[model samples]
Target: MNPDMSAGSHNGISMVAEGGYQVAILPADGKQLTLYPSLQIDRAYYWTFEAKADNPGDKIYTSLWGDRGAKTIPLTSEWQQYSSMGTPNPNYQYFYFWSVAAKGNVYLRNIKLYDAQDLDIVVEKEWR
Candidate 1:
């Protein structure tokens, strides 16, 4: 978002993503997102995102990235918050979010990314 834009609103708009395991600066349902990048893999840093569905019938999901084991965290239309505590993966370039799972109106906010101390690249022995 530009300096002129305000939080919780869609203005000065950029790219919008639909769903599932892909990366986007903004989540699908259009909520302002902010980030604090840390390449410090020494320990784990975590934050929470609260999703209040536009419709109570809608079941939503939330997900944050780590070194490994990435998936969507499920939530409902009611006010719900998800917390993550794990050693951030410096190996991964960018974190991703999606909504192909629950399938409903999803609102995402307060996303925090804590990276590892440093990235270690692994080389495979067998070539496919």
Candidate 2:
């Protein structure tokens, strides 16, 4: 977490009993949580994760490689899986999830970035 963007006592990340983590980003203007993952240039990958907000209709903004790939994801109160596929921009190396004008806690689990070619094998193993 960046000190400048920190929400003081209003934001936190904690481990959940079942699995994964709970990330709380309180309602505020310009508060963002960023995650940087090592990615191979020019490789197509599948980005997948399960997430749910504390309340129905909460929204989260996600950006890949700065603003080159941006998406507005609407979240529900119940856990749901989200996924996207693309090659990372060679110029930037970042993935971000932020609260621009929304509030509430968001639970995230099984966050994965897998090679597009290997995704089927990974999914098969998970189902077995």
Candidate 3:
């Protein structure tokens, strides 16, 4: 299916998806989503989002791919916050949100990406 955009809380953009599975690829290019590129090695970075599933167990997760390798965080169905950090590939750069095995629908909004050094500043742009 085609990607869609809709209103979310605080008039922020929200990503809606239905069917089997969907993902917002990263480097979050301006056209797709809004996230920074080229993470520093061994640095602590945070990625957060607000999400709810149409049904229970519609796995939501984040993927980090770098020269070091890859990492994933299993997310919940309820609207909540989650965070994780890992070594980044010096050669590769990017992260992504995945709705795996999603059978019904899902809503995601308020995405934030930042480093531990500064929680006060979000590095991502408004998703489009």
Best candidate per TM-score, number?
2
Instruction: Give candidate 2 misplaced runs (Cα > 4 Å).
Output: 1-30, 120-128
Q: Please write out the lDDT profile of model 3 over residues 1-128, one tens digit for every residue.
A: 12122211112224335343333322112122323355676676666566666666555545455422222333355665554444555655565555555665455555555665656654533221
Q: Considering every candidate listed, which one attains the maximal lDDT?
A: 2
Which residue runs does candidate 1 get wrong by more than 4 Å? 1-36, 54-71, 112-128
Q: What is the number of backbone collisions in each predicted candidate, taken in the order shown? A: 6, 0, 3
Candidate 2 similarity to native, TM-score: 0.65
Error of 1 at 24 (Å): 10
TM-score of model 1 relative to the true fold? 0.46
Estimate TM-scores for all models. Answer: 0.46, 0.65, 0.53
For model 3, the local distance difference test gives 0.46
Off by over 4 Å in 3: 1-38, 66-78, 118-128
Summarize candidate 1's per-residue lDDT along 1-128 as a digit string, tens digits.
11111222243224343353112233345443323343354564443444555455344322334433243454556556554434456664223344433333455544444332232532212211
